[model samples]
Every structure is written in structure tokens, then in C-alpha cells.
Target: MTSYTLGQKYISPTKPERGVFPLDHEGECKETMLKYMLCLSRNDNKPSLCQAESKDYFQCRMDRNLMKKHEWEDLGYSNEQQRKT
Candidate 1:
């Protein structure tokens, strides 16, 4: 049993704008995630160098229902096609 302060204000925590979702407990995208991480490590921690791996991981999450599905352009991969040209 604890006592409360006379003028203390209590603030309730709130969820983030995107809110929280279930984790990949079954490792549905573990390989893709590992590839992304490995790419980052090999590129001196530069994410720009791992765009493909990142996109693949995100796609895996969407396919496995771990996250909401979105377009590649909407996810900032609009230049992926151009880069391949």
C-alpha cells in the first residue's frame, strides 16, 4: 500500500501512431531480415546500399501478415525500377 501525492499528476502512456503489432514469432521473415542486416554490415552501416534487402524484408512481413501491405512506391522504393534500368 502506497500513498499518492496531493498535487501529483498521472500521465497515461499512449500507443504510437502506427500502433503495435504482433512479432514474427515463427521467423517468417528471418532470412530476409538477416540479409538486410548483413547488407548493412557489409556496407559500413549505410542503409541506402541495402534497399533491395530492405524491400524484400518488408514484403515478407506483409505477405506473412506481420505488417500492413503497401505499394513499393509508397514504401519509398519508387527508384528501384529506375536503378535497374
Candidate 2:
């Protein structure tokens, strides 16, 4: 059995690197999220095959303030423009 000391110091947990954001209570990004989910399902859960839908969903989240805005490159969509060319 472990014993607790009366003078034990308390250490708070650190925040996540990405930081927490508000929930999408208005269903603002529901459609985009569903699209991504459907794409994943159709692609046999292969995320690489659903990159477009994944980006769309994240874009929607950023637009609705559900998450912080980040550069496409930071979000791993840097090659998106190249793929379109």
C-alpha cells in the first residue's frame, strides 16, 4: 500500500499542443464531417484516399471557429495545389 504525505506538492497538467476549442453546437461543420466519414467508408478506411474530404472537413471546422486556423502546409495539405496542377 502507498501512503500519502501531508506536504505533497501538486503539479498541474500541461495543456495540449493543439489547444482545446469550442464544440460545434450549431452543426456548422456537420455536413463536411459527414462527407469525410463517407469518403473514409467508401475508401475502406484509407485516409490517404480521402485527403480532399479530410481537408474540407478541417476547413469547415476552422471557418466555424471549432478549431484554430492553420496553414495548409502545417495541416499536411501543402501538396494539394501541386496535385491540382
Give the per-residue lDDT of model 1 (tens digit) for 1-85.
9897989888898765552566899998999999999999999999888888898888899998988887777777777553762
Error of 1 at 61 (Å): 0.4
The segments of candidate 1 whose C-alpha lies over 4 angstroms from its true place after superposition are: 1-16, 79-85
lDDT, model 1, position 30:
97
Clashes counted in candidate 1 amount to 0
Report the CA-based lDDT of candidate 1 relative to the real structure.
Answer: 0.83
Model 2, residue 48: distance off in Å is 0.6
